[model samples]
Target: MKDAEKLAAFCATIADERKADNIVQLKLADISTVTDFFILCTANSEPHLRAIADTIVRDAREKLKVRPRKVDGKPASHWIIIDYTNVLIHIMTNEMRELYQLESLWGDAPTVSAIKTLRKKTPA
Candidate 1:
């Protein structure tokens, strides 16, 4: 996998560890210049959103040796975006996710199966 793909998968894994819901990774390389990939997931509440975002930032930095170039949004806003340049992590509350419908907004972008990526990177 490319470095960005690996990073996205790792962030998704970290979010999963925090019990984030409906984790998704969108491939936007061909469709958008904003980023190569987008990792979207739903957090149950403000605290859950904070925990997932914090863990992703902490683990990605500590384990992957990378940090987000910038972060936007906030837990109180029901969304948090961790921008890694090539991969943007979107952590949102269920309501916000449903309201914004990022999945549909970027409907043209293909979805990358986070579970499949994780399995391929894992050793037997």
Candidate 2:
């Protein structure tokens, strides 16, 4: 699939699982030309943070036929990174989010945020 499609599908699945809020997918094509997109989202707690990371990993593999090469930062919910060759998903708590602000660091990318609210569909 195209980078845009992979990103939209990834973000949508995360939203569907109710593991994200104010989600954003940034196309990091220019910055080192490493990944195509960087999917970012915030969760409430450690469990919720894991839930978000897990859902995205599962969905990308199951639906998109893509798997992350490595996963990190799971011990605590502060931040989690799932590294797909063409995309990287970041799941973080609100506090960590404000502190390490990825958007500011990668200012040149196009960040796409979630369209609808992902409020009440508790994790399975």
Candidate 3:
């Protein structure tokens, strides 16, 4: 499957496991230096975070036949980033999410979905 199609399946898989509060897809195809898309989301806690990460790993492998080239922040469970060549997944806490301000930093990226943002911000 194509990267975009695989990405969609990955997001839905994570959502099915209830590990993600919202999964937002940002197409960064135009940004040559950066990945093609940004997958930003939140997890309820450490276990939930792990579940999401695991889901992404499994789905990417089983469906796309691809895997993240590298991963970061797996130790803290605060923020976990799974980096595929053409996409990046950011699973973070509410405070960390705001502090990092990734969305603001990548303000130029076009948002393809507002799934988790539809409701008011809920505290974890």
C-alpha positional error of residue 40 in candidate 1 after TM-score superposition, expressed in Å: 0.7
lDDT of 3 at 92: 84
What number of clashing residue pairs does each candidate have, in the order they appear?
0, 0, 0
Maximum-TM-score candidate? 1
Q: Rank the candidates by TM-score, best first.
A: 1, 3, 2
Per-residue lDDT tens digits for candidate 1, residues 1-124, read 3999999888988888888878889999999989999999988889989999999999888998998998898889999999999999999998998999998989999998644222233576
Backbone clashes (count) for model 3: 0
Q: Pick the candidate with the highest lDDT.
A: 1
Per-model TM-score, in order, reads 0.89, 0.80, 0.80
> Worst lDDT window (10 residues) for model 1?
113-122
Q: Which candidate model has the greater TM-score, 1 or 3? A: 1
lDDT of 2 at 85: 65
TM-score of predicted model 3? 0.80
